[model samples]
Target: MSERANAMRASILRSHGGPEVLRLSELPAPVPTSGETLIRVGAAGVEPGLDVRTRLNGAGWQLRFPHVLGASMAGTVISSPDAAAPDPGTRVAVAPNISCGECAYCRSGRDNSCAQREFLGIHHAGGYAEFCSVPTRNLIPIADSTSFAVAASTAVSFGTAWHLLVTRARVSPADVVFVVGAAGSVGTAAAQIAALFGARVVLGSRTPQNLRELSDEVRALGVVDTTTDFAPQLESIAPGGVDVVVETVGSDTWAGSVDSLAPEGRLVCCGGASGGEVGLTLRDLYRRNLSLLFSTSSTFEDLRLVLRLVDEGRLRPRVDKVFDLADAAAAHAAVEAGGLQGKVVIVPESAA
Candidate 1:
C-alpha cells in the first residue's frame, strides 16, 4: 500500500503462431492511473478464445496477442490512490473493454459496438497479474452473497449476456429464447439471463452432454426446455418460431439459430466459436422480417442492472474450473475443450 512499493507480476505471449509460445514471466506491476483503480486480481478467466488464438494464430478470428492472456477478472480493489478505493474487501467483477468514451459510438450510447474499441487482454494490458489497473467505470460491485470468482466470471461473460439479451434483444416475459452452443460460458450466461427476464429458454448444442449441462444450469435458474436439435424442437415449442435467438455459437449453428426465429423474432449475437461464416438463404430473412441485433458488454447503466440482479439473488454464475496464473496455458486448453459446465478462471494468487 505504499506509493513506492514496486510490484512484480506476470505478462505472457505465445509466439503468436502456436500454443508453444504461451509464456509467462515476472515484470514491474501496474498502478492505477487517472480514472482507474488498481485491482489485486484474484482470478482471470482463461477463455476458449484465448486457446484458439494461442494455438492457431487467433488473429485469424480477430484475436491479437502480445498481451496478457485473460479477459475477465474478479477481485477486491486494493488501490485507487487519488480517487476513492472501492470498499476494502468488496469483491468486484471488472468488464475489460476500454473504449475511447468520447467517440461517436460512445456518445450515441453504443460503446460496445465501437469501431475503435480497445479490448483488455487484446489491445491493452489485462487481468493476469497481482494487480491490474482498470477504469472505475468498468467495475461491477458484487454483493456480499456473491463470491469473487463468480463476480469475476460475470464481468465479460455475464456482461456480454446482459448487453446482448437485455439491452439489444430485450427478451420479454414468455418470449421463447433459443441459445445456440448452449453450454459455453456466454451461452450459459445468456440462457440464465434470458430466463431471468422471463424468456422460455431452449438450448441447442452439438452433443446431448452439452445440452444437458445447460439444461441443468437453466433449470437451476428456473429455465426449462433445453434441446439438442433445432428444427423439430423449435416447431415443437414455439411452432410459430422462437422470439429471440442468442447466436453466440457461430458457423456451426448460425444457420440453425437463424432458421428457428419467428417473423419478428430477433437474433442477438456475441461470439462465433464454431466458425464465422454462416451461409443462409435470403428467402428465410426477407419472408420472416427477422432482425439481427448484435451487441456486447453492459453499458455503465446496464452494468448497474446486472449488479442489482446479482444483489437480488436472481442470477448466479457457474464456474467450470479454476487454474493458477502459471497454469494459464492449461486453462486456455480447458476453454477450447468446451464441454465445460461453466467458466474457467485463472487465480493469480494461484501457487506456481
Candidate 2:
C-alpha cells in the first residue's frame, strides 16, 4: 500500500465546545492490535447523548486530543488477527460497548453493568473516520441485504431499547407501554419493540405531526402531544395509566412520566438528554407503588438480538439524514438542534 493508502480521513475533535470543534483531517489508519480487527467504515450513527453532549461538555470522559466520536457504526472488515472474527470483506456492525467477559456481570448476562466497560467515542477512538480498529468481539456480521446506514443506526438505539423494555421493564401483551420522546432514534425503536412484544404502545412527542406519523407507522395505540401538559392527554389515551413507561427525556418528562404510570407501573430510564436533575415526590411514589429502573448501554447479546430483528424486518432502523465524513460538524449541529425524528448518520465520502 502507498503512504496515502495508509492514511485516512477523519473528523477530529480537538477541543470540546461546539460542532465547529469537529474538523476534517487526515490521520494514519488505525492498525489492528492483537484481538482487534480493522474495518473500512461505511456509515456511523450520531448519538445525541454521547456525541453531541460529549462534544459540548466533554461528558467527563478522559480524552486525548483530536478524538473520533461516533457511537455506532457498520462497515466491511478489512483484516483481523482473531480467528473468531469475520473474514475480510464481511459486512459487520460494531458493538459500541466493550466489557470484560470475565466480570460477574458478563457471566450473568448483564454485561452492560460490567465495571470494566468502556464505550466507543467516549473511552477510545470510534467510527468518525474512514477506517476504525475495533475489538474482534465487538464485530457482529451483518447480512448483505442490510444497508450500511440501517445497520449503523441499530446498535445503540435498538439495543438500548431492547434492554430497557425487554430486560428492565418486562413489557408484554398485557401491558400498555408508553414511549416518551417518541421521535428520537431510541424512542422510535422502543415503541416498535413494545408493539412487537404485543403491548399496546403509546407514543409521546412534542411535535404533533411527527408523533402522529410515528404512531401510525408503529401501529401505536395512541399519540400524546407533550408540548404542554401531557399528563391529562396521557390519561385520555390510556385510561388509568400505562403499565410500562419508557423514559429517555429525563427531567424534561420525568414528572409527566411518573404521572402517566399506573399503580406498580415500571418506569425504565436510559437517557437524560434534556437534563439530569428531576424532582420526585416520595409520597406519591410509595402510594402508587411505581418502580423506577435505570439502564445504561446494552449487552452484546442485546445488540445481536436487535440486529437479527432489524435484518429480519421485525424492527426497522430509521436514518433521518446522511452526511459525509467531512460534514460531521453539520451532523452534530443537526443532532444538537433537536426535533429530529430519526438518527443522523455520517458516512465516508466514498461510501456517500
Candidate 3:
C-alpha cells in the first residue's frame, strides 16, 4: 500500500557455502496472507546454528534456494489482515517456530515437540530483510522500554535456556548447573536462568575475556564461577561434580559434560554449534545414573516468559555488535570467528 511496502532490500543466499554466499539485493516485499502479518524488521540476530547449520549442511530441513537467513528478529507490525491481531505499528518480537496447533503435543503444552513443526528461517523466509510475513500467532508484544535489538536477542537464547534448565532439567536451588560455551548467548542465558532459580552455576568458555565477563555478570546475580579449562577446573572447584550440565558445544563438550555430572545428574543439550557427533556408552550411562535430554527450540509460552523477564529487568541477553542488513556477510564472518560473548545483530538499513 505504501512505497516502502512495494520492495525491500534483503540479504539473499543464492547458494549455500559460506559468508561469501550472502549477497545484498532488492527483493519484492512479502505480503501477509489471511492469518499472517507483515513486519517491518528493525533488528535480527545472526545465529550460527540457524544460519550456518541450515545454510552449510541443510540442518536436517529441506531447502529452497535463494533463501533469506535469520531466526531471531524483532520489528513493528506494518500490516495485519487479522482484525483481532495486534494493531499495525505495534512493536513485537518474532517467535520463529511454527507448529501444528491440532497436534497431540501442541494440545498438551509441548508445542516444541509438535511433529509438524517448522522453523521460520529454515522452513520458509525469515527476517534477514526489510519486510517479512509471519503467522500472527508468532508475534510477542514488546514494551517501550525494550529495544528491538534486545527483544530480537532474547527469544532464541533465553527461550532455549529457560526451557532446558527450567522445564527439562528442572534445575533447583540445591543443584549445581554447569553451562558450556558460557561466553556465547545461549550459554550466558542458561547460566542466568540457572542462577535465577538459586542454582550454583559454573560457566565454561575457552576465551579468557568471555569467561571473565560472564563470570562477573553471573556472580553479580548469584553464586557463580568461570573456567577457561573446562574438565580439570571443574573437577578441582566442584570436586563432587555438578547436578545439571547444559551443553551446546556438542561433540566438543559431550564427553566432558558426562564426566562432570554428579550421580543421577541431568544433562540437557539444545544444539551443537561446535560439532554434532559424539561418543556415548550405554553402560557408562546406566552405571552413572545420568539422564541425557535433548531440548528442541522453546515454546511460545517460554518466549513469553523470557520477554517478561527481560521486560522486568531480571534476564539480559548480550548484544555484542550490530551490522547493517547490507553487511550481513561481515556479520556471518564474525559469527564464524567465534569467542564472542554476545549476539551479533543485523539492523535493517532502513531502520539504521
Candidate 4:
C-alpha cells in the first residue's frame, strides 16, 4: 500500500516513576501478518487510564510496551491481503479487545467478557507509533463522514460507555445519572449516552475548567456543575439520590459516588484514578439495592453501533490536545496534571 514501511519514532517509559518515564525511542515500524491488516495510524489515544496502567508495571493488561504506549488508534487500511476479512483501504476504528474469537464469550458476542481477552495497548504493541496491525475482523468500516482522528478517539472510551449504559446499567428515562469525572473522555461519553436514553444527566468534576471545557454538548443534555462535596451536593440536586453513577475516579470519589446513589441505583466502574481503598458502611450496602458492575474493553459490535450514532451527528467526540507520537512524554505530563477536558492524541511521523 505504502511506497515503503517501517520507520523509527518516539515512545516512552518512566525510569523510576511519573510522566518522565515516557521517552520516545527509535523502534521498527509495525507489519501485519497474513490474516492481519496494516494500518498507517493517523491518530492514537492518550487516555488517563492508559497512563495509569502503564505506570503500574503493566497491571495485568493484555497489551504491552516498555516501548509503545497507546491502547487505541484510528487509521486507513494501507495493506490487507485478499484473504483478510475487513478488506483493504477501509477507514476504520481499532477495537481494543484482542481475543481468540473461538472462545465461548467471543462466539456469543460477549468478547468483552472473554476470560482470555487482551487489550491492544495493554497486551500488545498499540497505536503510539506510525503503524499498527490487527486482524481484519477487528476493524469496522468508517464512512466518509468520519475522520481518522475521530475513529481513533472513540474505540475504548465511547465503546466502554455504551456497554455500561446500554448493556449493563440499562439506563431509563426515569433514571438520574451522576457521571463522576464528567470532563474526561469516557465520563463525557457516559453523560451524553445516558441523556440520549432520556435519563436526567448530572455532571461533577473538581475544576471549573472541566465545567467550562466540557460544557458545550453536556449543556445540551442537562445541568453541568463543579462540586467538591459529593453527598450534599448530589442530594441537593437529585434529591432522592442518583439512579446511576459512571465512576472512574476510584477511591477519591468512591464514597461520594456510592453516597449519591438512590436505593436501587447502580454504579458502573471501569477505572480507579484516585487510589483504590474506600470506607463503606455494610448496613448501607445491604439495605440499599445498589449494584456495582465492572467491565473492560468493548466488542466490535458495540463499536459499530455506537459509531453509527457518531456518523449521524448524534454523538461528537471531544479532543483536547495533539502531539507527535514521539512526544508522548508531553502527553503524559499533560494527563498527569489532570486538567484536560478531552482525550489527547498522538500523531506518528507526520509532524514535529
Considering every candidate listed, which one attains the maximal lDDT?
Answer: 2
- lDDT of candidate model 4 versus the reference: 0.76
Name the TM-score of candidate 1: 0.87
lDDT over C-alpha atoms for residue 298 of model 4: 77
**Candidate 3 clashing pairs?**
none
Q: Per-residue CA lDDT of candidate 3, range 243-292, in tens?
A: 99899888867888898889999999998866888998888889989999
* Deviation of model 2 at 39, angstroms: 0.4
**Candidate 4 — worst ten consecutive residues by lDDT sum?**
218-227
**Per-prediction TM-score, please?**
0.87, 0.97, 0.95, 0.90
Q: Which stretches of candidate 1 lie over 4 Å from their true place?
A: 2-4, 50-66, 84-90, 216-229, 350-352
Residues 30-117 of candidate 4 have per-residue lDDT tens digits of: 6677778888787888866764556545565443335566787888887766475565667788887788888889999998888887
RMSD for each of the candidates: 3.4, 1.3, 2.2, 2.6
lDDT for each residue of candidate 1 in 90-155, tens digit (9 for 90 to 100): 678777777778888789877776777766776667777767778877787777787767776776
Model 3: which ten-residue window has the lowest total lDDT? 220-229
CA displacement after TM-score superposition, residue 327 of candidate 2 (Å): 0.6
Which ranking of candidates, highest TM-score first?
2, 3, 4, 1
> What order do candidates take by lDDT, descending?
2, 3, 4, 1
